[model samples]
Target chain A: MNINWGFIVSSLPLYEKAAWLTLKLALWGISASLIIGLVCSVVLYYRIKVLERLVRAYIELSRNTPLLIQLFFLYYGFTKIGITMSENTCAIIGLAFLGGSYMAEAFRGGLESVSKAQIESGLSIGLSNMQMIRYVILPQAFSVSIPPLGANCIFLLKETSIVGAIAIPDLMQVTQDLIGIYYQTFEALFMLVVAYMILLLPVSVALTWLERKVRYAEFGN
Target chain B: MLNSGISVLVEGINLQRLLAGLFVTARIALISIVIGSVLGIMLGLIRTSKSKVVRFICRFYLEVFRIIPILVWMFIVYFGVTNMFNIHLSGELVALIIFSLWGAAEMSDIVRGAIESLPKHQIESGRALGLSFWGLYRYILIPQAIRRLLPGAINLSTRMVKTTSLVVMIGVIDVVKVGQQIIERSILKTPTASFWIYGLIFILYFIVCYPLAKLSKILETKWES
Candidate 1:
């Protein structure tokens, strides 16, 4: 296979635009998840019996099913209910909802690992529940949560590729679109792989570094 | 309005085509699992070998598969391989090739984890028994390894079933693609057909994955004591 420098070079503008879109979807998706996850995690942690059951049901349903099916449901379901958003918004919402379930579980796991003795110690000093959590529990939970949380973020990056199915014009969609019109499938798509590598590999390296930093802090003499 | 009843709409999907789609997906998933398991276990051994170069190659394989989304991998192969090689293969065959490659990479890690979690004494004791290397691996190492691999293998089996949907994107007419075609036609032009059809798709995937999940849970409990 002769290298086609011209095709790859011409496709650069499309790749950059798609990469930017993918970045937006991932960044906003992760941000939305943090909000939904914190609320859902707290519900699992502190909700009364009824609310607890609701939370558990939601989490289990979300976790066991494939994300692709969930995206289909959101794309198909929302439009049925007279709620229509742009394809990009729909894709972002779908990712945030699907990714939120995983994030909630991560947060709940982190919250469980926090030592109860410290919370009791805080109470002894007249700290309220909110004060104890704010001042004490969160700081500790963040460290234990780093590795899994980073893993979830990495997964969120990959999951955004499914948005192409809904025609959201993110990285994968752009690659497919370029191939559809150009009749130059392999070259454009290979660049797509390289494009994704450039975006995701740095985040992975940064995550490993972050994990090490947290591990060192925990073990420092 | 896409009425949700289109999957089984009295006229939308003939009984024969629906059953045919189910069989096609099930068969593809079975072949991929069987092939993937054999390949995965072997590569897994290679992955855990002491040689640094072989180990690095295995780790690289695992990492690339781990980060790259399976669907994108599908497109790369579906478009790239067929045109590059000028092969006139069917879509189902193409899907099987790509998915099996993915399964091998993933299941190898499961096998690696299962092997390492065992006590080091097992390997050392087998050597102490004066058994030949092949004999040790055949009888002692693999028996325990089989037991550990069973639960994870079952999980991967279900993963294959769910992932076969990606083949639909390549135009293999799997369950999702069947539903998609129905919704695009005359009776299903509205929204509900897409919903209910997808709802059924969700149920079908759930039903397939749920039992393996439960069985794995039971097996884990059985192993715990």
Candidate 2:
């Protein structure tokens, strides 16, 4: 099997640009999901009856369905109604929705992990409910949730590949394009796989380190 | 006008075609799960073996599969390998292999976790009682691990079912593919058809997966109780 190394070398710049787009899209999706998750967790924590059920249904639907279909529903279904957006915009929104559902669970677990005594102590200090959450609960919960949030981000990065199906010129899209031109399928795909590993491994390692630090700080060590 | 759009969309929908699509999706998922479980069990065992090379290889397999998107793998098998090997496999067959490989990676991790989580003393006791390695696995490790493994395995199956939707992208003509085809044909008839066709597809997937999700949860709670 002849693997063409020269083709991959020449295509480095294209892959690099695609990698940047992937990261940018992933960052946007991760930020939006984090914000949504935080809001939903806070709402769930407060036990607001009606909104709680609504959020639960949203989470279940997003979590259960294939994210690709979600992308299609938003991308194609919206066009049929004349509400057309760019593929990148639709992808970010679709990914954010998927990540948000999973992150809500992660945040909920973190929020639950914050001891009741911590909240009681905040109350004893004459803090209001809002202040108690802002000052005490959210900080603890944020640290507790970081690792899973990191995993969500990594998954979001992987999910960005799906947008290529809709013709978003992301990494996978560019890879497929190069494959069509060069017919160096193995070399192109191998390089793209390695490109992803390069992009993702650091995040995984950083998250693990941060998790360790959070656990240590939680113990006052 | 609203009623007209709904009527137009509903008139274009075909239940038999959609059901056929759903059957293909189910068939692929079941076969993928069975293939994954077998490969996963072997990988899981290798991961726990005394040989460093075997463990390293298993770890590499698990990590590589976990990090890469399933879509890329599907593309590699369908588009890339076929270009090089001069061997033609059906799209459905390629998808089956791709999902099985993906599922095996996930399942191995689940199995490894379940086995490692067991108490060390149980294995030690079994060894002390003169059981061979296979005997120890059969008598002690597996029985305990199977309980913990069941919930995760079922959950993986559900995930497999959902992800099999990606196969449609590679030309497997699963439910999502059929939905897209129906939508394309009917879009000229009524733009509303795109919405309803995809919506119906979404609900069909939900109908299939929700029960499996619940079953996994029920099994989890039952095992713990």
Candidate 3:
């Protein structure tokens, strides 16, 4: 039961490759989710009738279910209906689907914090609806939303671990593959944990820094 | 084709097996929630302790859990730890331990936030009344913090339930695993069985989680007013 340093060293190349794939998936998923979230939150904020209801349902459905099942449905079940997608595609879509609802909730919270008086003042200044949303509302909302949005980013990043289940050969998948092949469970898992820490720690730190940077003085200490 | 898929759901005690799997999932979540809450409350109280070292330790624990994905933790425990220690542990046991620890870390933060959010004057007033430290917590802090923390705790419970789906990866025969088994067995006869099976699982999870989430919202709004 000695530590297999050599084995871990040899696996480094494989781990690096898998880590890149994970990073790629997370980046695409997170970017897509941000756009989806922005659109859905705007619809909800504006109280658009039919689209609002549809968005609400979509949000709940996405939020309540585990990302694993969503990936399963997309990767496996969809083939039944002739909607075949690549593992990477399914992984990205699943991550975005889950992340979007969370990000939408975050954005909605930010949008709601824009005071009614602020909106009226924007209108008083002859700001049109789009102009108010663009100039007045968005800046304040973005500031307010930074922390939760950052949190959603990290959550979605960690969630990329499960995309291994779809055979995407992400970090987790690589770790399991190493374990299965080498039967060096401890060494494989240690590398897995290290890989995640390497991936996540800087993001967490940067987000904290960003959250502080965006904190408005008028919001009070 | 749809009829065959539907029949796959109800055929030969399949529904019962899925129910049993759901029960296992619910049991894991419920037990972990209870244990996690109790431990979390204690850790949270310690987190706000006067001692800096204790608070630092609690913070470190929370950060460790936060940074690592739960799936990795599962692998480490279910695979690595047992192998390293040369001891046997069931997948369900490993899942319970990991989930409880993770939940406790999360719940502790919620507890700490709730307790800290109270006005400083509440503590000052309690001390003025000649209350001991424990007396202050019992009589002044905890009662109020419970109401504030309930919505957050409920939300965490829903998260725990949803996350229990991960146990299947560690070889626990949870609801998701049961669905996978059914689909594999019926895939040839009903190629669309995966659709119906996974869709049912999606709904089952929704049924368990959505109400809890809704209740958390309701309490949050009700108490906000």
Candidate 4:
């Protein structure tokens, strides 16, 4: 029943490196998803009917299935058709695609929150569609989008762990790797839990602060 | 194109294996739902108690599970418990316990939300009518909470079905694990086996999840009205 605190202490440096890698993967993945989400949201917002069906299919497919299967499908399944990519590349792409679907839903909600009156005002002043969206719709949508987007970021952070299954060397991968080598299961797993807490605690706190700030602004604070 | 993948089927043995794998997944998810709902409802009730300490403990349990990945939680229980106590629980047992814990945390939130949204006058009126603590919840509160909880509970059920795929990471021979094995075995016979196998898994998942998701939505809108 004894936990090896000393072993965990000795392994702090390796855990730290893995933590950094996890953060990097989450950052790149979230950024890619946000871009994809924004574009998809824009297409849907404009009522682009033909593309909307394709986008909805992607979103529903990604949302319903397990992310692990998607990662495997891309990582292992692709090589069969003469497409090859590194583990890390495949992880990023998979994470981005998954995150993008959730982000698109958030963006759709945000875009809808931009009041119809504002768009009408832009039209009354002869503002072109692009100009109206740029000057009026986006600013408002950005505020409404912050909270859900932040939640999605946290979700994506936890999802980065799955990349380890594909041998991407992220935080969870490192923990599992350590477990395999050292056989210090409790120590490694405990360290893994603490490492995630360390990363998520501050990010969640900052998100709450950001949400409050945005809400305050909406209230003219 | 599709017929090529079906060519490997011999008296439906592969199909039977896939079905068995799916049965494992379903059994795990269903067991977790029942266990989790009971545990979650208890935790939810505890969270809404007047005692600050009780509420704090329940909230902590809920938040920790909410933030951590189920895969890590699975490892923590499966490996950490085995290592620390030298116990030899099977992977399926470990997965069941971990997923039930996860289900409890999620259900607690739903239960909490449903309870909080109810009118306060009911609780007060029950108190005024001299209902005891247990009587108040049993006679008045729980029935309403159960009604309000149905849509969310169903949604959680669907989510649990999807999330059970994580057990594959722990070497549990669930549907996705079986699919992986099938592809590996058949790879020599057909280079596209992985794709065909995974595509089937996706469809299976979609067939299972899509209807539940649709039901959840319908219930939600129905309840809202």
TM-scores of all candidate predictions against the true structure: 0.89, 0.91, 0.97, 0.90
Cα lDDT of candidate 1 equals: 0.80
Per-residue lDDT tens digits for candidate 2, residues B90-124, read 88999999899989999999999999999999999
TM-score chain B for all models: 0.90, 0.92, 0.97, 0.92
Model 1 regions more than 4 Å off = A115-136, A217-221, B1-8, B12-16, B126-140, B143-149, B187-191, B221-225
Flag clash pairs in model 1: B1-B190, B1-B191, B2-B190, B2-B191, B2-B192, B2-B193, B3-B192, B3-B193, B4-B192
**Lowest summed lDDT over 10 consecutive residues: which window, candidate 2 chain B?**
B1-10
Clashing pairs in 2: none
- Candidate 4 regions exceeding 4 Å error are A1-6, A117-136, A219-221, B1-6, B9-12, B121-148
As a whole number from 0 to 100, the lDDT of residue A44 in candidate 3 is 99
Residues A10-93, candidate 3: write the lDDT tens digits: 999999999999999999999999999999998999899999999999999998999998999999989888899999999999
Per-residue C-alpha lDDT of model 2 across residues A47-145, encoded as one tens digit per residue? 999999999888888888988888888887767667798998998899889999889989998898888888888889899988987888877887888
- Fnat (0 to 1) per candidate: 0.45, 0.67, 0.86, 0.65
Chain A of candidate 2 compared with the true chain A, TM-score? 0.92
Q: If you assessed candidate 3 against the hidden native complex, which CAPRI class would it receive?
A: high
The segments of candidate 3 whose C-alpha lies over 4 angstroms from its true place after superposition are A128-131, A217-221
Best model per DockQ: 3
Q: Candidate 4 - CAPRI tier?
A: medium
**Candidate topping lDDT:** 3
DockQ for every model comes to 0.52, 0.66, 0.87, 0.62
Residue-level lDDT tens digits of model 4 in A1-221: 77788999999999999999899988999999999998889888888989999998888887788788888888877776678899878888998888998899899988998877888989999999889878787777877899999999999999888888788777788888889999988889889999999999899999999988877334222
- DockQ of candidate 1 (2 decimals): 0.52
